[model samples]
Target: QVQSNGTALVAFEKATGKVRWAIGQELASYTSPLVVTMHGQKVLLYFARGGLLAVEPRQGKVLFHFPWRARIEESVNAANPVVVGSRVLLSECYGPGSVLLDIDQQWQPRVIWSDAGKDRWDRSLAAHWCTPIYVDGYLYACSGRETPEADLRCLDYNTGEVQWVQKRTGRCTLLFVDRHLLCLNEFGTLIVLKPNPQKYEEAARYEITDLEYPCWAPPVLSDGILYLRGRGRLVALELIPSRK
Candidate 1:
């Protein structure tokens, strides 16, 4: 959680909300820490304002730390590393774009690749917001570029090659719900599509314009119903028809 003094506190959770341990730093963190288990070992990955820190979960013992100083500007990697197999894919904005690291090694992390063509690598931007969805030897990223138009990019997971570029004139977000690929645009438009291998195809399209300002939050899909909120109003709609 982000503290008031622009510092961060890494707290360990115990039984019944009892504090097991925590680490406070001089700078706050906006990036969310990701916890994962590999080979029966649970580890906590934290990307703070200053740099990246890894710690053990049993007693909060720090494993190792490394500073990312690409530029002297205020920088912190917000794109939580996407872990696949023994590799972790991490992306950053502002001075850093994206980097792939190998986590199976016994020593510190090793960098595999980083893209240099993109100007600003803000993954949360229109063209960069799509989660790096991994598929048959490919990873997909959708974000807005200089023209504020959403662009769907299919990149090679290993080589980072541009497979295809599709200019989508809208905002987009992706999530998997009930075996369906859920996508939403900025203007309260929802599109359910399957992550097709050949191209993008929508399974269902619906609009939820509430006569309010633009939606700033991502929509949530639950059960067979979709829920969205704007301007202190909650709109819930039944997606698939339920059994009579």
Candidate 2:
């Protein structure tokens, strides 16, 4: 297991807690590393403050690095990288917008396209910290700055085109399940909607009045139980289908 500070990555043995390897002396971002298989080998992708670094897990060898960060000094890359097929998708709310990188057979990375060239705030999907979920060749995520300005959007995964946007939804943490989106808003309202790019379709909604703080943590589902976190409490709700 590896842990990251604002600078440097330290890998330790899980059972013995001994240092196995240590690499990376660059500034770090809030995003965690994603272990993925690219080009038939397992590699760790770290979305650091300066860029994205692909590292060999066991040996801590730096494979490649892709620069991605906000031009503003205060902005940081806090979202994890999304891997699709042989490509990697990256987006953040701070700097420019999103970028797509294509990895070839030789493990070299190339920029397929980038939305950061557009007006900073006008990018297709400016995700703050919440990573997006890809469904049927499309991306569904909460896009915008924060709070009232945030919107739930569906965009073409390959083209980065906005297919539809649902406004006034507040900042949301989402989970895609069985072709549906489980959106938990900041106000603790849970909304179930179809993940349709053509239009907005609501299936059900429930407001958890006991929540004391904004539900910013991502909603997690396990064994038919949905778990959520608020200011000081954790909630688990059982998901049972309605009787026919």
Candidate 3:
């Protein structure tokens, strides 16, 4: 279990709840750890306060460490690292907008490109906590630090070039499935849109008026039912029609 305030990461055995291994006296952001295979080796990445660390999952060995933190005092490393090929993309709204890193076979990280060097909105995708989903060489995401200024954006993932931006969707968390982007805004509104970098084509919208205000959790799709978390309740809605 990773501490909420970013101090220490503890791994536990599922059945017995025994502490398997605990590593680091490091600080972490609000984002969670991601396990992925890099350069043909399975490694765990923790975006900590000091930097990004690649650790051996089972034995708790630090393989490589990459320093990355927002320069602004109020800023944080909240977005989860998006792994592209042998590269990883990190972005935050407060500090540098976005940075692309190339990881070689030796597991060394080198910054290849950075969008934060430009303006905030000019970056690939400046997100608060909404992690952009990359598909078909493009990225679809909610870009901005606050709700009023947030925009639904599509960008070229490799070059950090903006394709299009739609301002109506306010600070959304999105999930991509079946070539469609399922976006859930902070207002608890669900919107379905086509995943296209050329333009924004919204298919439909469903608003949950009964739910309490500020639903920031990302919508979850399990089996055929869609789950939405509100103030204090869990809502389950069946998205697929029953076969009768």
Q: What local distance difference test score does each model get?
A: 0.59, 0.84, 0.80
| Model 2 Cα lDDT, one tens digit per residue, 36-131 | 998888988888887888888998888888888787888888778889878898988877778889988777889877886798556888888888
**For model 3, which pairs clash?**
6-28, 27-49
Candidate 1 lDDT over residue span 1-244, tens digit each: 4345523544646555655666646365456777887546777777666667677866777776655423655554544556676566655445555666666545377777764354664332222334556666666655552236566556666765566655663645566665556666666777776666567666888777762445435567788787776556778889788999
Q: Which residues of candidate 3, in runs, are more than 4 Å off?
A: 1-7, 13-20
Residue pairs with backbone overlap in model 1: 6-28, 7-27, 7-28, 123-128, 126-143, 126-144, 127-142, 127-143, 127-144, 128-143
Worst 10 residues of 3 by lDDT: 1-10
Backbone clash tally for model 2?
A: 1
By the TM-score metric, which is better: model 2 or model 3? 2
Candidate number achieving the greatest TM-score relative to the actual structure: 2
TM-score of 3: 0.89
Report model 1's TM-score to 2 decimal places: 0.76
Across 1-244, the per-residue lDDT of candidate 3 in tens digits comes to 4454423566788999987877776665788888998777888888766568888889888778877666756667777888878888887787677777888887788887787467665677787888889998888888888888999998887778889999967788998877888998888898999987789999999997766667778888988888887788778888897788
Q: How do the predictions measure up, each by TM-score? A: 0.76, 0.91, 0.89
Q: Where does candidate 2 stray beyond 4 Å?
A: 1-7, 241-244
